[model samples]
Target: MAERKHDRKFVRTFFTTPTAVEGEEDSAKMLRGAVGLRGMKAPDVWVPDNEDATAPSMRDEGAENIVEVVAENGADFPGEIHPRVVWHRDSPATRYQGFKHMLQISDPERGAIEHIDGFVIPEVGDIDDWKKADEFITIVENEHGLEEGSIAMSVIIESGQAELAMGQLREEMGKPTNNLERLFLLVDGEVDYTKDMRAITPTGALPPWPELRHNTSRGASAAGLIAVDGPYDDIRDVEGYHERMTDNQAKGMLGIWSLTPGQVVEANQSPLPPENGSWLLDVGGRKVELESEDGVEIYDGNRLSLEETGDGYVLRVGGDGRELDEDELREELLDMTEYVPSMDDIVDSMEEFEAAKEAGRGAIAITQSATLRIDGVEIDVNKDRMWDEATYQAAMTPITLFQDVYRNRPDQHEELAEMYSEDVVERAMDVGA
Candidate 1:
């Protein structure tokens, strides 16, 4: 069989920093220098200073690629320039100050989907509050007409609650919206197992084992979450770091942030191969022998021969096996492969997965479960489903899961909007309209 090819997409990093009028030219020079070093053009530049003078100055200095200007505390800028630049107000206490800023300009109708960053704010509190935060997110989504996969929500998981609520956070943020597309759980700051217990135990329960110091909380439910220790920490040599990240991908997280250039290069280079192998097929309780060109063959009582069909291969089973439907037989064969695991591969995969899982647990523990109700479902730390390797990978890469969810449960979009407040709704409308 020919090897399957996987294409990796590179995400551009938008750097954010405060600029001063005196240092405007120097700032532009530094930015251009940084751009040169990163081997890319600047996507957007955030001028934190609220003064109107700096915006025009930066614009005049050949920083024409600057897409938006962000200010803290809702400070307004001069109205002389293009209305394309958006203004956003955010609390300094939240971890997503930069994300909220970029989201203001993220309008799918305008074809403005770009990767951006938000400064990580260190805030401490109950991890359960992420549910309410999810509610706040819904408000933002409703107001802005944000839809799932429209704009990515990258939360800096600095607190215990932030880390604990990652799963639920992703789920809530991932609700279908007009503009939203991806949700990223970024574990920023120092990876302190003691202080940030939310990463260790997302559910608000005592440690599963007494020996485990960290208890679980509500925030750790979403699978798309990824944890990088911190900007200051050494990026190259963290324990179980790659597995923790891959585990997040397994859960549904697409990407992580705050990584240095070297770290980013390493992550993009990791190998992920498809699980492939041969398996025995039992069709309608009848067995058959299928042979591969590679000389690998499994035999059952029923005789099966492969005949070349136009543009495809067909299996003639049971000799007189009533001319099988081609589509049905193909489906059955695919299903059979999943059930029959290659013992050698499974053993090797499990060994690596176990080591990574233990390291992930040591660095950050996840608690997850699920419940179904006719009226509505309630998900939290205690009520959530724990993520095994497979589930973790699925949650981390939400593009895949989002497609699945939209196909499976199209009606859940409205429920997602109801979680937000009026302010968010108004903001969403202002931008989208």
Candidate 2:
């Protein structure tokens, strides 16, 4: 017995010719010879729907080995194709379900389709038109659990109405959900020269030309994932495409894709970095370092110092050592300063000099005799009377004078008033001539 060939051969090709029968036969013959099926069992051929008619004998001769048949263009077959062929249909329900089946069967890695997936064409004009689209999105989220930033969806912008409604669509889809991530914009329709003409070259002599303007209007939050699909004939003529993309990136756009591989390459090359640390504030010139009693030193780059004031720590800046009147600090200070007594009230209790004399306090005498006058004097007085009345009056006289001066003519004695109490003034007045 001859040994069978062990080598396995595979052929891959696409059928684009108009004659489907010839294409299928050619594909089958190519595979049969490559797989060594001349004398033994013949190899099977797999042809897409367009080329299926060529293999008339395949149904009887090679049906058993034929693994799968894919229908390329789904437009012709409504329900004839396999239930598994994930159709890109216009019906939202079917498309959403088909997307889920594709995910399950494809068993793609998590986040694999996040950067590339499907598109969503939002309803234009009245918001009521969007009710169906929103409901469809909710179904995708609740039933499929797709998650934002995990899949891409594009919106078709074909009409003037769609352009006007772009803002509303962005706002509605800007939130986090397990439906999809990103939005790709598709601009369709022709430029109307009569309505959209603009003067060119700025020469004022040249005739005006129609200007084509299409935009990917994105939400402030969704700017990062915003993109525009294109194969536009006049895209190269657009003055601000690159600038718009740059601005979009500044507003947090990840990148832009115009559908084709070339566009994808260009967009991916200029993608914003995944994580930007640009917002970290620099405090080199404005910072201050403080050492606490616990030996814990803190370098406050913002110049905010926390120090114990009364009940809590007060915030102060280092330069002028000025305490900040933060709301909390003010509240704490208000609590602390309540019911505090002044220095004058504390010192007014002193009554008599004889009492000080009894307590062995020495009196200071003037070096030279000074002209002094006594008022309301009754010189003849008993020791007890002198001690009780005269000594008390002498001790308190200075205090009384000081209070009178402070109340009557305080402008001249502002400094003295600040430093010394009323009792000190009264004593000085009594001793003076």
Best candidate according to TM-score: 1
- lDDT tens digits, residue span 272-318, model 2: 11111111111323322232222222232444344545543444444
The parts of candidate 1 lying over 4 Å away from their true place are: 1-24, 28-128, 131-149, 167-182, 186-188, 191-232, 235-259, 271-433
lDDT values, one for every candidate: 0.33, 0.31
- Count of clashing residue pairs in every prediction: 65, 11
What TM value does model 1 have? 0.34
Estimate the Cα RMSD of every predicted model relative to the unseen true structure: 20.7, 35.3
- Residue-level lDDT for 125 in candidate 2: 30
Q: Tens-digit lDDT track for model 1 on 1-433? A: 1111111121212122222234544553432333332211211112222112245444332222323222111122110011112112224333243234334434334332232222222332333343333334445456667552322333344455544454344334434431222333343433433444543557642232211111111232324233332332345664444654454454333233323445443342222222233434455465333443333344433354444445544555555433335555445345433222222233333344456676775222332121211112111112123446664453333223323222332242343234333433233223211
The TM-score that candidate 2 achieves is 0.27
Q: Which ten residues in a row have the lowest lDDT in candidate 2?
A: 8-17
Worst 10 residues of 1 by lDDT: 372-381
For candidate 2, what is the lDDT?
0.31
